[model samples]
Target: MGAPPQPRAPSRRVKLFSAWFWLYLVASLTVFWFAVVIPWLVITPFDRRRRFSHWYAYTWANHLHAVSPFWTIVVEHAERMRADQAYVLVCNHQSSGDILTMFSLRKQFRWVAKRGLFALPFLGWMMAMAGYVGIKRGDKRSRERMMAKCRRQLELGNTIAMFPEGTRSTTRHMRPFKRGAFVLACESNKPVLPVIMVGTHETLPRDSWVFTLERKIYPVLRVLEPIEPAAHDHDPERLADAVCERMTAAIEQLRAEIEARGGLEVRPPQ
Candidate 1:
């Protein structure tokens, strides 16, 4: 064979003006935030220990995914997640959809996200009301505050989820791991749960506002075996490296599985 045929580009018209797509997103945000999130915020105290808001947010997120006709999320080994155990859940970031796909885990965790995400309109407001930690990158004071908040959350028997890459990978490749998440794990003596998310970039690539509806996107969320903090002897750098290696391997395995299936439509086992 001389050359393989390349994939066709998505229709620009459809990307820009998909009536159902836009309507679904708009209605999801407006109705859910106004009808559910706002009411919960009003009824609950900001510092309440019971995470009624997070549960509502999780349900809303699942509903949003369920309404998307072109997308399906399959989470594997989700039963490995324990309700009683607190963990530093570290995941590789690929696209904005990674955040949405994570809710499939259905595990209660406080997200450690960038400060800017905390400034968005409805989403950010909901995150704040749900008590997620926000850090201003490169700001020492902000980092300190974030770490303090994470430790406190752990003390309260809550898991903390962080994107160890610190930013989305434009090419869906693994980037250098950041130490914040590992440090939190080592300091708190919690297990580091490595979660690999694949196909998110295909669903919605970085810097692209439009959803790629050319093909059905089946995103996979795999929760690998957790690494105990004691194994790293409280060294965040080493723990980060180990977790990164495991995640990279897990991504490769996911890709191989997809290839074996000969398509991206294979749903991971329930």
Candidate 2:
């Protein structure tokens, strides 16, 4: 024994299945992007665009469920998400795959995405149509504009989804929560809903653009009990810490299960 025995390669059937799945996802996204998305963009008037945008988002998300391979998405404590309520929803930043988790909710919420995403052609236009508020982290003026828009959106009964870590982490360890989300909750006096997204990073890590598949590796979205902001408001840093701690614990527990299955360890991005 020169060395430990090597593992067998994936079977032909497995390889073929993966190929078909990739093709299906590409074809589906293309049709939806052009046929559905383009028409909605063209037909819907500027002031009334949100309705069409929401419909488009819902349809696209449902399409993902139809085309996804190898893994299922599980939502826990979903009752926490109420259609009648307006709250500030915050989650950890992981892979772009996390978009599936958010879209899977099928609820109408505006995203607070980085300005860069807003620069994409059709995607940027669609996001704006959907009433999404893009934030430019580089400029103070842009930061002020984003804060104002978020507050206004909340007032208008729209929920805002934000990633408190600012950027996706390469590792499982949670990054220091930023103060913007907490500040919004406090200033707006809206309830903050903490969401824990598990396993998305492993499903599609930051450095890799290729989609990977694994058994029982489905992603999980756990809606933790909401954190209601006091009328007087607490220190923004403290509120941010409390939210960060709760989500970090949930993610770690999930990581343990994957590790026990001999999956690769997800390290926090530096």
Candidate 3:
């Protein structure tokens, strides 16, 4: 099997277009900002779950993909979802672009992000409005509150989404899984839904934004079969490790498939 493809350098034209895209993105976001806020504020009073916030945020975030025609996201196995069944979703954190890529799932789940990110001027406040959960690293008390809140959300029949690695990875190398998400799965008796994401960092590299058309950059999100609550026998550590192992292997397989098609490159858009 081939190793995961490395990031490719962008041509001069792509770089210039990226600069312009960013400009257009910022303006669009600014223009649409109020549309989300007004509805969120009105609905927060009646909808304790802020379910509308999730949909609004999902819609708003997905616009990031409208920048270029060549930039497309491929979603797989989405049919596995069933209406009204809440779940605990765990996915690998590859790049910041995931903030946008994830919305493509079109599934309603409260996101668990770092508390620091929730403090970013407008972005953080928007997250707050979306009712996403945030955790403070190494702050035991903060973690406790986060876990409590997540448990409550689960009890309310709302799905919870988290990156068990705790933070983003610049490459395909994932960090150790954190136990919080798995613990929730066990305690809440909710099945764990593992998702495999590939090619996100290459599309929007952590250290840089440059990308080349030398190969097609297909950001794929694959939702795997759910792991029943009994699969881990109520053991959080076992659940975490089991999910991690399967996800790691699945990601490797996905990358190998992509590599087989010739270096993540596709013919330039016509």
Give the top-scoring candidate (lDDT): 1
Predictions in order: lDDT: 0.82, 0.73, 0.79
Q: Write the per-residue lDDT of candidate 1 for residues 1-270, one digit (tens) a residue.
A: 312123346587557544666577667776777877556756687546447778878888898788777778888999787998999999888788788899988889989988998888877877887889999999999999999999999998889999988888755467798788888898889999999988887777676667766656688898999999889888998898888888888888888898788657766544
* lDDT tens per residue, model 2, 1-270: 322123244456556765776577566655666776566657676544265676686677667666655556666777898878888999887787786677777777888988888777656666776788988887889989999999988887888899888888766576678888899998888888988887676566665455455343556777888887772355677788778877878777755665676653333222
> In lDDT terms, how accurate is model 2?
0.73
TM-scores of the models, in the given order? 0.90, 0.80, 0.89
* Runs in model 1 lying further than 4 Å from the true structure: 1-8, 12-23, 37-47
Which portions of model 2 show Cα errors greater than 4 Å?
A: 1-30, 33-52, 214-216, 254-270
Pairs of colliding residues, candidate 2:
170-267, 170-269, 171-267, 171-268, 171-269
Better of 1 and 2 by TM-score: 1
